[model samples]
Target: MYPEPVWTEWEDPDDFAEAFQLHVERHGENVYRLHKAITAQGFKIDPQTLYTWKRGDKEPRSATGLRVLKAIERRYRLPDGYFSSKLAHSGRMITGGGLEKLSVVERRRLAWHLPDNFDLLPRAKRAEILAWVRTVIISGATDYRRYHANAVLHRFSFRFSEGASPLPFPKPRPLEERLADEGAPEVGRPVQTERAPIILDTEARDLRLFKTATLTTGGRGRNGVWNDETANQKMEHLGLLFGALAACPEGEVRGYGAPVRCMTFAVLLFPAVWDWYLRWREIKRGFFTRWESEMLTVVAGLTRQGTGWLRQSPHLAGYLRPIAGLITPADIVAATEDWDGVCETIHRHAIVRAKEVDRVARVHRDPFEPILTILEADSPLGEYRKISEEVRRRRPDRRRFPVAAAEATRGYLMIRMGLHLGLRQKNLRQLLVVPRGRSPTPERQLEALKRGELRWSDRDGGWEVFVPAVAFKNAGSTFFRKSPLRLILPDLSGLYDEIDVWLRLDRKALLKTQPDPRTFFVKTVKNKSNSGAYEQHKFYEAWRSIIQRYGIYNPYTGRGAIEGLLPHGPHNVRDVLATHVLKQTGSYEQASYAIQDTPDTIAEHYGRFLPQDKAALVAQVLNQVWGS
Candidate 1:
């Protein structure tokens, strides 16, 4: 669904007859040939009408004229929207795999509507689809045998039938088959998975020792005027050293004194040191993000510089601060052993950021749009009756309902919460229907879902969700911040009512085999633990998988809505909610509270209100004061 190019010079002029005559003068000889090509693309306008318009006897009026212009633009490889006025629009683009250079509108469309499913498709099949589209453009047709040529696949129903659809996943092996992930190449030495794993290597184990931790300057900031309270920290910066040792390519861990290892260790400390002092150096966070931490882990593994950091070039200052001096060569020498916390932290950060960076790097893309549109009122996000009928056609119920129905319901409910509330991944994962009393065990939660008698906090009134302070990213940090404030789950009546049905039907059915499903979300396929929480990584992967398999991505951009036809990262929910609230309310105070941030902070980053909004706000207040 590529956007129709907007002709900047000719927006709503008196008449397009002048523009039509000019086009005819330039393409006098080729006009008839272009007419034939346009006809091939399903434009049914008579050639006589085209000549009449070009000769100034009649101005072009039908949509077919627009389609002919598009065909001519492609056939001649003309500058995008070159001969366009406000009138000409084909509603399609150059239809081959190799498109003509993108127009201004096309660039915006590509940035916004790059299909999430496009990259997920297999290389050969992707070529086939692209080639099919190219053929359709040449022949000016859409239907071909059993398949249809759509710029973006219209529905994911074609997904199951695609037979060769390439999902971006290693085929899932049953948990038993992956006991050791035997065939996968070791990234560094193999890591552990047991809760509280022990890193067998000795140098890394030092992080757990009390002596390895240092008592850094405590109480308040170095200057009391800067921060309200300065709490001293007892930190084990040795884990920072462990980051490099464990991150090295498999054989390099033991060769700590090697020049290459020395350089890698120093390089690792540079970002960690720069992280503490330079506040806004990182994106979207007051402090260093897990992305920085993960970047260090990758630098250690991939780069093989030999003590180049010791050369004293001013360039080194870009990464290293004076604090890096405290981490000496001996510290690197002593860091041969690996610890569980160090490895797990590095690995988890790597996994999370890998997905995060891809979307973040593409500044304005929203890969979640198609799915979100389908979730609108009366679509899958609500009663899901349309989706139910679709599924029921293909799936025979094995139990009370088909497995497809259960998965679809659960997925729809999860996405709806994200769009409506802007909840974070962890916040969604830690949700509890058994309210704020003594927390419910897995057995109790399971029983509650099945019986439909959830332990509501009648004290706080029913359906109150208590988000623990520990869930905040800043929870354990002693950085500049305000008092911890607990957030109330936004009260949306019909929304919570949907949760009731999900728990009773979808969730219960998914976990029916598990003797104990500890968390609200359980694994679709059996893995390690009997029934455990859906980890953040798994939650995002599932969301993406479901969206690509079931929805559509819009080709048009500039909808001026927050969520559109493409899928986005789970973290973007907070952004979508904050920006949307600001656009609607025009108050930073309202946006801050909605996103759980300070007013200044919300204005600095999250909100995207227009300048006109401020002018409107002033008028609104004056009207309120004087009774408009």
Candidate 2:
């Protein structure tokens, strides 16, 4: 039997060099003898290489390095993966073995999944491994995933410069001048199509004013100010609208070739323009969608009677000019004289248009498609927990891979906390964090800010969450009744330990020197531009990324937890919670409590408990009588 080597201070070796040296000492072997033994076994290794490993100069990473380690392990009579497991704890990814042929991105992605002896494998075997990894792990082969992949390839949107001023409309050029301009150049220059028009300074200023007016409180006849999220949504919606208008009919967007230079806020005054845009959307998508309906609603808000910014700004009508097919000079003159009447007409038209679009609107994307596997389960909550488990299992060594470790911890908490709270994305992203010793944020302050907080509850003797009713989207619902939500978090699955680590070390590591947004979750701070706050879109992406990495099981790699799982955002957690409650209690009211919603809402939207599922539940109790 190989005897354990006595250390000077009795500290166990962790790095490869110390461990290798200790094993060598235990076997009464030196570097020369190990080198000779390895060479004799048809594995070529230098004596100096063993010396370097002993001196802790470098640890094994490549296939050859692994082979040498295995030979040393064999010489010492140690268990398989003994040295490699120790190397894993070193924090550097074991790569560069069979991955020489792959790109930098591919190597990084495949490093965790690939075996140490990957390079020693046959060419055919390597190809098979690469193919499987790419298909299952790198590129998910789901039908909707395929659709998304293909959809992003065609970029149709245009970006407008905010600084550019409106140029004077060019008069018709003489026929000879036009012909001469049209003539091909003699040089090797590439021919270019007509460029998209730059947004004028006036046009940019109008948009800024419109957004400001909408966001400002208590404007004349104004209903309410838009929140930050709503304001952003409007900005994006209008950007797409104008981008489509400027797009060429012959191009990928296949839009009506309205001259962007001639188009201004005045275009919103004409009913013909809105109708054309609606029809274009319908034709492009091959059916009416909720997008068109929502867009119509936005237009209605923009041109509403007394409160409408466009209704008040009659001067914008003068900026309108004639386009070849879309607009006429006569339309501009008419709009300038009766801007308020034009606004009233467009406002009414939008309302009517919205209803029409809604009647025929088809559901383009199924909200439940990505999470069908989780929802169809008897215990959806239990099924979804597998993702959190996968994250915990794959958590990198904190000592070696601090950033990756922090990210893994963050991902794990995101899944765990989401399942527990069943809160919407906005609430989850904006949930403030207060450390255990710190005073919890007051209920009044939280209500004023329309946000929530996670803090230690000294009275309850556990971690607690307090969310003001006003912070919720459904604050007026019967569920709240003006009462705030308060829950003491049970310390399940080492939750407290993980949370402590996150608050003390991982959170600080992720934030670095960046100004903390004080949210429970923080983005991995890589640069000055990264504010460490989770915006709506970025937060959704982070959740989806977690699902992609840990939730979706790859049969080839055997890494992820769940089978048949697709990438999903945090919102799907509500469906899982609702469906789980419904299955267990067979009470819609009870299910609604899980998601802080109403029974009717759960039945209509969240819970997918069909008639057959209900019948099966009843049948289970009835069948027990016969068995007895």
Candidate 3:
């Protein structure tokens, strides 16, 4: 059966008011004029109604109401997606576009066209022109009608060529007159002037008007003067020009919108510009470098005359007194040398400090005897036997049941297997206890135990457990390809018999509920939810509690909890496996291959042996090896 679609309309005056206020504030005075213009154009609504609609005071009455809303949208020159119901669903308000609509290709073409006619205007006028250009570019206006207004304004305000010749203004002239103009002498054509001649004062004074205007616009004459507004205007002009250049195809601007977009543009473009300037030192006969160096020298002179370092600091710039000493070439060289030395010294100090920090942070706080020492202990296994015997002695009384007896037994067996196999936690979690071959009852416990496979090859015709890489951390790498671990047992048949008895006695109930017959780890009476497994944290806790209750402490360090247990919640079991493997093999390469630790790291950290007593370790390993 088909269901009917449902829709709901929403209205909120306060939200609308707030949204409108924010829009006005961000777009500035022009927004108010736009609002007035829209109202005066004679829509059947009052200005207040329009305001209320914009503020969310009223929902659009119908689809026709949406057309009115679209009119307001056009006035603000909003982005394509603005005012759509999608904004309502997404909980965002409509606002004027901060010029993010342009495509990458369009922006590149705009940038290429800019440098040709950029220089011949007053700072404020230049800023206005660039701002309009930015708007046109962002609006994606490729057609003449869409961008013609801005282009006309820009051409009217600035000379398009070096001779101060005006740009050609489009007019309704006759075709015959235009053709006659095209036949004029070529000698009067405007020349393209490079920056070098102007900088060197080789060109006539009138030809240097653009550079002179820049300085004057910033309120600094040949003798220097204070004009705050001029400085601001010049800065605004430079920002616009740089921003436009950065938007060009060659520039590396990223992202969209104001502030962050501008910052992204600067982050990408500035490095490229700096790199090019550096390289130009060789190719351009050092002209660019010399000019930059001279500019820096002038700045340094101004900074040093009265302020010194305090005056030169960015924080105190406006507060500093003017100075007059010129920075010499020797001074520049010396400063560079000092900076390099300081940086080198700081880097060396950082390395030393990091080592000191690491030494202090490496505190391991476990309260258990090391497993090796416990295994080596003269009567470690005997202690367990004694405890079991005592519990048996008091078995007539149910209250005398051994505390954590099941957990202690299970944890001891699991840890022994982990130490032997170096299996990671994920693989251990998914391990099952199923019979090998055609036996009705399970024989051997296999890993990577996929369904229906009684046995599979382990690479070299040896019996092994296959483990998949997805169970490993670096599963994507080809280095640790799906491999098998040899199932080498001292008495394989006897081991299988013991496992069969354990499963029959301990996990019979849990096995009944599972639909799949191939699963290995059956739920036991001790773990009620026994759908074949426990969480990693629960397993760690069980191990920790058992070790603590047993009072097992390492003989060498006198610590009791697992060797490297940390409160990183769980997952240290994997590390324990890795550490034990490394200790046994005495070869990082072997340990890495067995435990999935990178061979490179193993070589770096555990490659060499420390001066520890061999006697205590060998005895402990032997005792623990047989689970005595």
In order, candidate lDDTs are 0.40, 0.74, 0.35
lDDT computed for candidate 3: 0.35
Residue 392 of model 2, lDDT score: 86
In order of appearance, the predictions have TM-scores of 0.41, 0.80, 0.30
> Ranking under TM-score, best-scoring first?
2, 1, 3
Predicted candidate 1 versus true structure: per-residue lDDT over 211-247, tens digit per residue: 1223212111111111101110111122323332333
Ranking by lDDT: 2, 1, 3
The reply for model 3, stretches above 4 Å from the true place, is 1-409, 438-464, 476-479, 482-494, 509-519, 522-530, 551-585, 603-628
Q: What pairs collide in candidate 2?
A: none
Model 3 is weakest, by summed lDDT over 10 consecutive residues, at 260-269
RMSD of each: 19.6, 6.4, 32.5
Instruction: Report the poorest 10 consecutive residues by lDDT, candidate 1.
Output: 223-232
The TM-score leader among the candidates is 2
Clashes of 1: 19
Task: Please give, for residues 159-194, the per-residue lDDT of candidate 2 as tens digits.
Answer: 443322234332433433322332221222222223
